[model samples]
Target: MVAQYPGMWSGRDDGATLWGKLAHDRFRYMAGIYKVHNWIDGGSGSGHNPLFAGRIEYNFLDPEPSPAYYTASTYYGKAHILAIGLAGQYQVNGVGSALQKGDYKAWNVDGLFEKRIGTKARYDVYTLEAAYYQYRTDGVCDIASSFNNHKADYGNIGGINSGTAILVSTAYLIPWRVGWGRIQPLLRYQQFRFAHHLYGPGNPKTRQFDAGANYVMDGHNLRFTFDFARYTPASGTQSDAFLLGMQMQY
Candidate 1:
């Protein structure tokens, strides 16, 4: 897969092309190795920065990694399941500007678990995901200042910043019938904190509470979701947001 973002120079595009293959499919243990080249070609200055990443995973209870989406049958099964993953990334010429200074890199590891209790008609669904990320930056200008300004969040905005982040989210799916679809009510909480200031002077931290429901029609391929979220930052008043969305796939 190739990830591309609109470049700061208007016409050029920043690209991170990744290639990988999944290992032997015995249904229990799986792994994949991927290499990525992140750079802005044909843009201004010297943009030859790149990053490479790899991940390995193991599943217990069931014999495979779960599907990418939660509305699939893989998640609504009658089994106690657990999956663990470890991943890392390395970067060269971390700063994408001609005035390159330092290199940036990060390591991440995560675990996911799901369990279905009782029968399909009166079952309880539980899922938990916890992840940790460690970052190392040679300097405050590690990421091109131009590039950081283009990002929408702290996670993507790189800099002379070194920090660790911990995130844990757990959601319970209660499947209740509504018309021809199944309505699954979900409750989730997430917290993220950075040891150093991610955006500026103060520590960048946020805690969010989300309540949502999904109308699963034809699984995740065709579904509707309604969610409400409240975010509490390190400072300032809490912010609230709502989302109503639909997904369609062939």
Candidate 2:
């Protein structure tokens, strides 16, 4: 939800951007300036103004040693970590129809903590993560307008507008392995509050809960997940789902 909410990559729209990052043992900073457009419709009236985005993180324990700007959700007991981050985005005339354009702005704060306990040969891994997001637009960029039109206007400007969201997750990796992998039980929750609903007149909110387990063969490189989810929406009937997924890195 955090990745999709702020329109990460500006909804993957085509454009040119200048991005850079500064990383150190104790902190990391990344920022970018983008002149994005809806090239899918030949660029049209998607505006020429630039969009600015950036994120900064401070590490209180062992620093994330990755050279990349992004960090993983967990390190699989490889490192002890305690980190907090802040991120934001802004653009003038970023959304709404051509005649009623509006500015777009979003911000979020997140934190992660991971620790390994027990003996060196049988250490258990624990991880916890949480994030909060707020997004807004100043003009007539409601859900309907944003979804119905995407060529002339940036519209929904990242699939969301004028709302707040939150996500929380936790996981515990067992110290003992089972066959080729170890089992990690996890729980996650997400909630979204929209200032304007896609239908009707009332503000709508949605909540989801997920319980799952991962078979970790080589950390995130080789893993399988089995999950069950339940969703509740302000105006819709409750729904449930079962998901099976796998991940592999070569």
Candidate 3:
């Protein structure tokens, strides 16, 4: 959920960035300055001003030692972990059309705790994670108005950008193996409150729930998931779905 948020970093874009990270003891810090929205579409209302982003984390238990600053949802009982993190992003004239631009800003706080219990031969893994986020655009981009005027792409501001969101999840990995793998059962809840309605007068809140089990064959390298989900949109019918998924990594 955090990665999918409006201002969060997910992957590369049509721009350049100067970024670095630092890790010392139980603390980790990273920051970057970006020259973004350089595409010809001119959909970011961006100018010479750069975007700034940074994150800081503190580990209360075992420190994460990944040199790439990456984190996993579950360590599969390899180690005990407890950590908290805060992140923020900001850019001038980052949202809305060039003629009606707005400054973009976002921030989030998150925490994770994972531990293994019982004897080594029959231990179970427990994980808990949560996060809160706020994203804003100074109220300059009206999505409905932009869509009606065919200016939705004027600044990549057509989606649900200005909102407050939250997520909470818990999981338990049973020690007993099922065939060649172990089972991890998890439950998650998420909610988003939009800053403004997209169409008519109504509550601008969306929610989702997920209950699932993962079959772990080789940690994150190979796994299969069976999930059931329920979703409630801001102004639509509630829906439910079942999913089966497989994941593999080198």
Candidate 4:
């Protein structure tokens, strides 16, 4: 077994194993395996429960060896790229419930389309990403716990609840040259929903809108971003927040 971090096996989890990607042009595929300790079903002597996951992605231009965890692009100038991906995961008696046999499953699919238009002095970059996720578990009680416990994409709501979610986001960038380097104006919109309404009457449904600007010095190596976001929840009050951040990469 292999892990991405040192001492990952020190916790309740035994170890993590990853299967590298096999790629051909625009297509890429990979898988992962891991196990968690089960103290109930006879402890370590009963063997650790297993978890499995796999992903497949296709990038239309400048292919990548594997799927990216995020759906954003920082490319400028003349370029066009579009990618689609599908991923799924399964866990056998994981995350606090040992009720019955293996009884949790999750699946998700997404697409990304990004493009840069015009020349150096005047260019526009835009990207759109959309995704959908489906979750199922053994019982209502298990589903309730999984929605709050299971950690995956789209917040803490994945892999074992009887709910559905869809997320869509779009971003646009306009860049201009400055004395120090380049300044980029970014605008983004996001919408997320739980179509099936897991908690019924008063569950949270989220929507967010953000606008930001970035200062790029050495590619993505050195950058500064300032943005404001307005968040609204269907079952709660609305809040507005702002952030100023610097990113440095060697």
**lDDT tens string, model 1, 1-250?**
0111122332122444343324333122223222222233322223444455455566655644343211122354455667776766556555434354445566777787888777767776777777777765454334443363544332223333456666666666665556877776677666655445445566666678888877877765688989998988768579999999998988
- Candidate 2: count of backbone clashes, pairs at least 3 residues apart or interchain: 0
Q: What lDDT is obtained when candidate 3 is compared to the true structure?
A: 0.72
Model 3, 1-250: lDDT tens per residue?
3343332224333344443344545777777766543211344443656667777888888776454246777888887889898988877776665566677788999998999998988899999999999988787652332443545434333443677899999999999999999999999999987776532355387899999999999998999999999999877699999999999999
Pitting candidate 2 against candidate 4, the one with the higher lDDT is 2
Superposition error at 11 for model 1 (Å): 21
Off by over 4 Å in 3: 1-24, 35-42, 46-48, 142-160, 197-203
Candidate 4 accuracy as TM-score? 0.67
Weakest 10 consecutive residues, lDDT, candidate 1? Answer: 1-10
| Cα lDDT for residue 5, candidate 1 | 19
Candidate 4 has its poorest 10 consecutive residues by lDDT at: 1-10
Kindly indicate the candidate among 3 and 4 with the higher TM-score: 3
Q: Distance from true position, residue 81, model 3, in Å?
A: 1.2
Cα lDDT of model 2 by residue, 140-245, tens digit: 3533323435433443233445778999999999999999999999999998887664334676778899999999999878999999999998677899999999
TM-scores for all candidates: the values are 0.69, 0.83, 0.83, 0.67
lDDT of each: 0.54, 0.73, 0.72, 0.55
Q: What value of lDDT does candidate 4 attain over all alpha carbons?
A: 0.55
* Residue 100 in model 2: lDDT: 59
